[model samples]
Target: MKPLHARYPFMAGAREAVQEASVDLAEVVATDEDVVERALERVEWALTDGTVGDTRRQTRVELLSYPVARVIVSTVDEHICTRKYAQAEAASAHERFVEELETETELRSTRQQHLSLDALLAEFDLGTAVRETGDGFRVTVGTYLELAADQWGDEWRLVNRSLVDGEVPVDREELYVLLKQAIRHRVVDGLPLSVPDVIAENLDEEVERVRETLSNMDLTTEIDTVVPDLFPPCMKHLLDQVQKGEHLAHHSRFAIAAFLTNIGMTTDEIVQLFEVNPGFGEEMTRYQVDHIRGDTSPTQYSAPACATMQSYGDCVNKDDICEDEINESHPMSYYEHRVEEADDDELTDWREGAGEDGDDDSDESPD
Candidate 1:
């Protein structure tokens, strides 16, 4: 969104030059209109009276034409000079002249600002090029005949040959009318026209075809119909579940049907609810019904397979032991159990003898 002046510095100066030139031209034209008129009259009188020699007469005519021409020429020259200065002011600016020219050309072409066929003919003295072939006529500009001959071979030959040989001759007025009709057909119906008769007939046919198509189209037909009551209750419920952020392993359609069946949802009511709920669609509800009932019907499961645990034991471990606790009376019991049974008996005998000796000494001293 940068301004054109900011992006292209040269354009800024060019624009300023254009404005100055325009103002200068306006002032000159306003003040000197009578002078220009007088000059023109003088040149005209010279031409009529033969008062001057041929060279002087030509010079007078050139002088008379100079004012108007100079306005245009000087403005353009100033614009160019300003643009060069602007470019020098911002040498690092991106190269945009070519791109701008191309964009401008495209816009002008699309807006039909380019010279019309008739205008080109008048301005360039270029005639319409055409050719003859067995199929139809091919018409193009004189300069484009070679390039257009391929795709429009038959039509080109027919039109060109007819025009050249004066077989289907046409005057300027007739040609204009025919050209307008052809252009209209090409623009509106995408139909190519080679001859005037063909153009008229094809245009009519294309119009009729379009009318027929429009008449046949039915806008009221239901392209996407939904049946709510037919959807299983579980499927509808699954829609709610999914909406609530619960994940499902299998297709929700089967799950929804199963859930509905489990909750005693009738086929008719399930379908009705499905129809009423904006969240659930008929296809999803159908899928749920198929999934829950082990229904292998074509309508049951449309999604790919998913993994799920069928029972709690399927995912539980029965052999796991608690290693963080030890018996209070036998902290080393676990380690002792790892010892040989014979070694354990010898350790117990030694502890018992030590307990008997301590008990005897305590009994004698207390008495």
Candidate 2:
């Protein structure tokens, strides 16, 4: 098996490599212990660490494990699990590609086969769409829209970028970011594949383990009650920025929106919260908030974990409650903890007075 395929098993070339090798996927899963073990590691590490775990030394094993891992994930058949696996795989590939790009030209060649930036772009048919200028690159508006995720932050939004003609300017770092999203889209495109009965039966144990891990990681919080005062520091910070008509990064917006959605705020209420923002557009705001609430999207996301919040520089003003790693590792968990500790008298139901002042203002007759 090619080392390049092992490094980027999501690439179409890698699938072609496997097909050319005439590898029998079902037979590999049933008979190859190393491949099966590596496959299990791929899924498990993805769940636990947001990585597929390194197995670079065993090229064939690593390459074969990817398909086996897909089998196991498909057999498990959980959307969240599937999403996490795809994300982790995409992330690992992004890191490797970035490292290769940063390597000196002479040194990169000496290294085992690796796809150059131009080659990688060509592989995805982005050659014409992403053109390098003297200072940076300008991506075609069409390609930019297809790859840029609003979830990355405000910077990725078309309105927030410099548009020249029909192209949007992006620096090297931004191009890499788009490529990562491209990899993720490719990886997740045909996911939850239809597994043959033999392969599914062979992977039953791995499937069960993945399910168990998913259960533990399921961040779904059922908070039918609304108490804004109990919001975690990160959520509070994001919400404050929104109410003050300050610009919020996309990740921050997502963190707060997901946290609120999980904590019983309807899409309308959430949209109202952001109406004061300078960049607010009623339709887009409603659509984004609805997307986060899963009213208009396929995936229902929970508030990011504390680590993720910190990663995007969204985590701020950690109080004593947040300092406790045991209980407050996630914004939703922190909110849940605070709600549990709060007495009824100390909690204000934000829902009770929500939009009432606006309603009153509307009802007032013009004198």
Candidate 3:
């Protein structure tokens, strides 16, 4: 059997009922504290004595199964707000909550199957006298019954006749394979595999076939080119570098993709990078591209770079900031120094100074 969520159409009904009950609870409970208290007491009395109590006794079903009753009492306990006021108003509000809950419960119960093991046993003409053992329930069956039995046996004796030595021997390998198949099946079917017996039985080829059918589909178009023309220029450059024997790290591609994309790198450049970079996987590159295109800020590389520098500060140089100079100091600090040097160079003319080239220095010296 599939999970209730998957097999039973009532799941949708249950969900709808719960939602309706919640709305009703909100509408019934008085907004003021005093009015709410009085209204809750009245609602509680109606639930305990009038509808909920009666239904439980009549149907012999648990209160949890009734969404309306469950909602009202639970809401009272949870202190839901109601809009009613005045003594007359409180009574009216209380009645509305009670009525709503009752309606929801009736709707849900009417839709529910409410089948028990005994009912199923009767349907299959199975005997129920077998007592439960530590492992599971056991029963006796005749040879005649075995011959006529369907896939599911009415009694243990008929089922055991199909098993070796009158008992089923567990196959560990088959069990694992079946379990994996069952999980996949449940995922595709949107079912919860809560029962072990159901999982064990459904974890075979049928489930696998269902899962495969749901999953099998191609969702991509192929563009032919060693370096695709559609790729962004920066990405193409990086790809060229990779193809030329530059050992690009996985994080480097991610970082560069973020940087280029932030600066308006095109899709062609992105595709080219993936094509040329041996370190990059097609799927991984696609994921990065999607991330860049999405609402996330184009700053993925900074954090990882900072983390790397922090953990391995001694591996970098503080003067040049170049990868070669990155040794035993902060690489960012080295890069900053390089920027400072470039700024100084741009501001000054170094060839105009020295000795006789400058007459002002001699004049300033004390004679």
Candidate 4:
């Protein structure tokens, strides 16, 4: 078990700063209660950039005792580690906050797969048994359902605005939507909160350390800033979603990483790009990026076809660029044509299949 200072050396200078903030927490929280968000902004840069493959430091995130560490880590862990928030990655001497995503809020539930009136009743769990009727389910007052029912009529919180103390018929679609919301709320609000102000200087110092670490990486590849604009719309959309912290479907993620590797981005740069995503996990991102780059094996993989992107729901709202007649084929075909048009100066470092083969070393694709 590494101490906090050993795990996060940038924290050394910030300890005094955080101690000061803890003492003034009441005053700070009174004015700017959103210091929690401020803490998250800097902590994210620290965690993601500082410890990419360093398992020991990453594993020690559980021991951090800084104020607002819980909330800040909560936001980052969900995306960076893709797990429910842990106040500490391990059990804490303080109150242990266990955010089990499955029992809390599962994206897919058994109820969701096989939904039926009778099945719904068995699981409705309004803090009591669901009273069934010939017309619909009965909702009595003094039940948890009452809180959900209060928002009656259109724009109601509960699915059925027709909820009543006696009996109101339920729509299957409405019931499903209601259950879905219930699932989301648990995940969204399950993060633990701290009562006092978090140290700003500590966060700033940690963020600086992360920046230094990234800047020092020996990235030899050069990617054109304009290159992303030429990506097929499905790829562009997937990139947009991840950059905005949205999680990608498996195919979209694989497709984008493969496409980037083909277009002259190095493994490190590609990994950094994935770090911006909400579902970023160090091990998973590293494994996938390496696999796509052919660092793991000799298999050369190509980006998925346009048809595959459509199947993943990524190729939508065909932007003007995506609709171009020239790029109607596979994503790699689009890159192959566009690179040929780039200035020879930019292509000075280029080689055939370096963009699509995922590395300077080339291997023939099975396709």
Best by lDDT: 2
Each model's total of backbone clashes: 31, 2, 13, 4
Answer with 1 or 2, whichever has the higher lDDT. Answer: 2
Candidate order (lDDT): 2, 4, 3, 1
lDDT of 4 at 102: 23
**Residue 357: error of model 4 in Å?**
27
Q: Write the per-residue lDDT of candidate 2 for residues 153-245, one digit (tens) a residue.
A: 445656567778888899998899889888877877777789999888888888888878877864454344566678887888888888888
In candidate 3, how many Å is residue 230 off?
24
Over all chains combined, what TM-score does candidate 3 have?
0.20
RMSD of each: 40.3, 14.5, 30.3, 19.3
Candidate 1 global CA lDDT score: 0.32
Arranged by TM-score with the best first, the candidates are 2, 4, 3, 1
Candidate 2 differs from the real structure by a C-alpha RMSD in angstroms, to one decimal, of 14.5
Compose the digit string of candidate 3's lDDT tens values, residues 1-367: 1122212112344345446545333332223233233323433443223321112221212212222222233222211111111112223323333343345555647654443334323423443422234654434323222322211212212222333323333233322222222222221232121323332232233233322432341101101011122223333444456566576656555545654444333455455434654555666666776676563446333212434533533122222233344422322233223322342224221111212122344442222
Among all windows of ten consecutive residues in candidate 2, which has the lowest summed lDDT? Answer: 358-367
Q: CA lDDT of 25 in candidate 4? A: 47
Q: Which ranges in model 4 have alpha carbons more than 4 Å from their true place?
A: 1-226, 319-326, 339-367
TM-scores of the candidates are: 0.15, 0.64, 0.20, 0.31
Q: Which run of 10 residues does model 4 get worst, by summed lDDT?
A: 91-100
- Check candidate 4 and list the clashing pairs: 62-89, 79-278, 262-355, 262-356
What would you estimate as the lDDT of candidate 2?
Answer: 0.78
lDDT of each: 0.32, 0.78, 0.33, 0.45
